[model samples]
Target: MGTGTGRMASVLRGACMVGTMVLLAACTRHGHEGYARYRTNCGICHHGGEGMKGEIPPVSGRVDKIASTPEGKQYLMHVLLNGLNGPLQIDGVRYNFSMPPFRAHLSDEEIASILTYLATRGDTRPAPVFRAADVAAERAHPMTTTMVAEERRRLDAIHPLP
Candidate 1:
């Protein structure tokens, strides 16, 4: 009886461990989905948001604040859909890499998820989540990478980043 009870206790402990893992996974599923999308699409350029100095701009620390505003939000969506070219300054560093457009390969939903993933990273402030509808709105008016750069210039003139 004692041996039987010990075996039962060990089995119960294993079951509890499995249950906890499942619950944790379930809780983080949406975030994981966004993260996975980011990995597949944006990670190549951004390097998991760390970014290369004087090359790719880091999105993890900067995106949340920019995403909080209306124009900033639109700019972000446009950048993702159409990509951006030419020199851009972030944190006083100039990066001239031309980002390629993702519209041909990614769906609106995937873009929204990737944006949401980027916006939430390393940010203390509440950032607005991008939705598929927002992507669709931007998709309605497609912009070339050059056009995206022009729009970024206009947006930066209005809302200069600190």
Candidate 2:
């Protein structure tokens, strides 16, 4: 009986150590508060920024470019706050899904963080960090998803994808 109990204790310790390592790795991979917020709020569709190619546009590499310009920055803020309904063509691929509005659920700070995370990942160019103030300003003048889409169209005309 003593031998069996000792073996069981050893196995339990080993299992505990493995669990701890897994938890630590997960935390390391998703250490930023913005990354956590993004996983909870946007990852379902965006898939941790990889996106669903041909359906949802990838936010990682591409968002940095879009967030570089003034009007483009405003467009991002509007899209996050108002959500977008589309028939939108990104890089010649048309995505016809609707992105649900997060204005009611997320605060300006959280939205800013998520956008910052999206804009910074896997990018070489120096992009401006999105601030809570920027989001708050956009929130002051609420636009519908349709309006956001129109703004996207205008921006697209000026900066067509390569």
Q: Highest lDDT among the candidates is held by which one?
A: 1
Worst 10 residues of 1 by lDDT: 119-128
TM-score of model 2 (CA atoms): 0.77
Query: Mind giving the per-residue lDDT tens digits that candidate 2 earns over 1-162?
Result: 699999999999999999999998854553386788999999999997878867887787776788888887888889899999988887777788899999999999899888877776846456557889999999999999998989888888898632
What TM-score against the true fold does each predicted structure earn? 0.80, 0.77
Worst 10 residues of 2 by lDDT: 120-129
Q: Which residue pairs overlap in candidate 1's backbone?
A: none
Candidate 1 ranges with C-alpha deviation above 4 Å:
1-27
lDDT of each: 0.84, 0.83
User: Which pairs clash in model 2?
Assistant: none
lDDT assessment of candidate 1? 0.84
lDDT string, candidate 1, 1-162, tens digits: 699999999999999999999988863775787899999888988987988989988888777778878888898899889988969998788999989898898999899888887877856456568899989989999999998888878878988852
